[model samples]
Target: MIPATSSTPPLAELRGIGKTYGTGEHAVDALVGADLAIYPGEDMIIEGPSGSGKTTLISILGLLLRATTGSIRIGDREVGQLGERDLPALRAKTFGFVFQGFNLFPALTALENVALAIRMKDGKAKDPEGQARALLERVGLGPRAHHLPADMSGGQKQRVAIARALGGDPPILVGDEPTAALDTKTALSVMELLRGLASEHGRAVVVVTHDPRLERFADRVVRVEDGRIESNLPRLAQAS
Candidate 1:
């Protein structure tokens, strides 16, 4: 089902999405008829309890998994029915992902981590070090560029992760529990950095986290429970 095109269409749209595991009495519905529209220049937060299917929802959004029903559109392209071979190109080109655990290579330094991402996004990246250092500097990690993940604090490691995610200049940034491992101050700092990036580039930022502290940073807060969205509302900042 195609949605009517708007002057500025959503970076990604999820309509009547459903995801189920198993079958018969043993079946578990992880998501049910979920509808969401993520736009550029907005930071959207999806929060809920541990079993509320937040991760499942993000998995589908990142193209790491498929919905059982309904359609998903990235910009104007409907990707729900796209074949496996077609998904990697679109996902690499459109989405950048950061995870709860810093998924950096243990052996690689921060600069190497970001450079690898640049190479993955564009096989022929010119001066990968130049691009990597610029991204690290953008994330306020220029001084830590040569540091290994083990040598940096959690926040710094996450910063490297974020910089790596930005390698392709993806239109959408997807974070699953991005700040979960950081302390309060660090988490807020990370959130501020993410918000600033999204605002500056008009890119969409989607985060699936259970931290209530994150609510204040979101333009829209969505609550998911029992495999369904309980509420989706704009925060005061966006409402004004």
Candidate 2:
């Protein structure tokens, strides 16, 4: 176990992280001593080919996976040793996630979907419906708040997903190939929305994608290859 420190104040930190699958001769190293730090309002893009541990890194960062041998910290809290039951609260309070597939309920309206996330975080919060409606409006989905996922277009569905992810007002947003099925223009629009969330709202946004065009919207682009960070570079900010 790595020694815990109290100096660093990043939103997320990974130190000497390593993950392996299988055993003996069949062992596959997914991550090898990977270290990363993300601060608030940072829009980071992780780029790499398939099977390069990009997803593994995102899963660990999002608290969905544990490192086999390393320390992970979210804010000042050390999460590398937390129990499974404790993870949900941390995830709900600290991070929002948007996936390639819009994981919205087909039968539920957009408003309901967003409200469900809020209710999951705080079952006793009282007026979750009203809060969800406001979030939908904030995401420019007010007109279609009553429409189900089936009734919305791909972009609209993604927007609704964004709204749902923001239900708890998390400080960090994690997205995994969120633009996979969208057209180039739509993908750019989604990237813009994510960037806006980081810059305008001061949320740390981390995106894992293979799209090179997305570098345009990233504040920092960290390329991963063979379970390691090959390069990390900063990019010019897009004008609002």
Candidate 3:
């Protein structure tokens, strides 16, 4: 379903999405008629309790999982029906993901980590090292470019992870529990960095986290309970 009001079309959208595990009497409905729209330059937060199905929702949004019903629309295309061969390229181009764990190689330096991501995402990357350093600098880690993850503080290591996520400049940045491992202050710092990416860099930031402290940074806060979007703050944030 297309958004009715036209400020900007959604970068990605979920329409009547549903996901079920198993079948028959043993089936579990992880998501039920869930719908959402992600827009550029917006910071969206998805928060829910342990079994609220937020993770399944995000997995589908990132193209890592397919829905049993409805559409997963990215830009002008409906990706739900796309074949496996067609999904990798589309997922790579549309979203950059940041996992709960930093997910960096212990041996790779900050610069190397980002550079490797650039090369992996775009095999034809020109001057990968140069681009990597610039990304590190963008995340305020320029001087630590050569340092390995073990040598850096938690915040610094998370910065490197964020820089790596920016490699291909995907329109959407998806973070799953991005700050779960950090201390309070450090987590806020990392969240601020993410907020800047949406506010200053015009990238759509979609974060699935249970931390209530992070709510202040979002333009829209979506709460999922019992597999449905219970509420979306500031109703005008998107076209329903």
Candidate 4:
């Protein structure tokens, strides 16, 4: 295991970030002058209605999409100017992603899905089956590790997705509407798992969601409207 650094900087920082699509009269600004900071051990929820730029922001933060303007720093590296070739390496080293649909491969079992991600990072043919099993167990999916995604419940699939996201042990975890498809109870369980990843494991977790119940799970809530931040508030001290 890699030793934890005593004085690591913030996991991610975005300054004056802006993203625009198209040109001239057809131009649409998805994000405008947005700025944010995410620190280790922090759970942040970005809340917005449709077209409010929550997805756009997550993409930028995850290094999947570039900002048209402003600077973004992931740890000590400035990613705003990195070439396309450099992004895969940086993404593999620093970030993990969870999607709303779970995005698990149909042919692969839960364990294999996570093992694939671990393999991507280490570039070794060595089986990551044991590591994947440990991760599944951590997320309360130990018994389902050998099951294909189709055999699992909605909540179970999401749990497998979470385990896969953490398989590489990346410092920053980004989720795009992870609970959009779950029932209330299952959604709460997923949120609890994400909270544990941030608070207990010291990962910076950013989630995009419109579910009001998530307000209880987040340390900070950032509301975005019209492609800009409308408000950023820390949950009441007692709430956490």
The candidate that wins on TM-score is 1
Residues 86-201 of candidate 4: C-alpha lDDT, one tens digit per residue: 99989988888999999999999999998987887877735688888889999999988889999999999999999998876888889999999999999999999998888656
Q: TM-score per candidate, in order?
A: 0.94, 0.92, 0.93, 0.92
Return whichever of 1 and 4 wins on lDDT. Answer: 1
Report, for every candidate in turn, its global Cα lDDT versus the true structure. Answer: 0.89, 0.87, 0.89, 0.87
| Model 2 CA lDDT for position 163 | 91
Candidate 3's residue-wise lDDT over 109-171, tens digit each? 999999999999999989999999999999999999999999999899999999999998899
**Is 1 or 4 the stronger prediction by TM-score?**
1
Q: Cα lDDT of model 2 overall?
A: 0.87
Deviation in Å, model 3, residue 110 alpha carbon: 0.9
- Which is superior by TM-score, 2 or 3? 3
lDDT of model 4 at residue 29?
99
- Candidate 3 structure, TM-score to reference: 0.93
For model 3, the local distance difference test gives 0.89
After superposing candidate 1 on the true structure, give the runs of residues whose Cα lies further than 4 Å from its correct spot. 1-6, 237-240
Error of 3 at 3 (Å): 12
Which TM-score value belongs to model 1? 0.94
TM-score of 2: 0.92
In model 2, where do residues sit more than 4 Å from their true spots?
Answer: 1-8, 236-240
Clashing pairs in 3: none
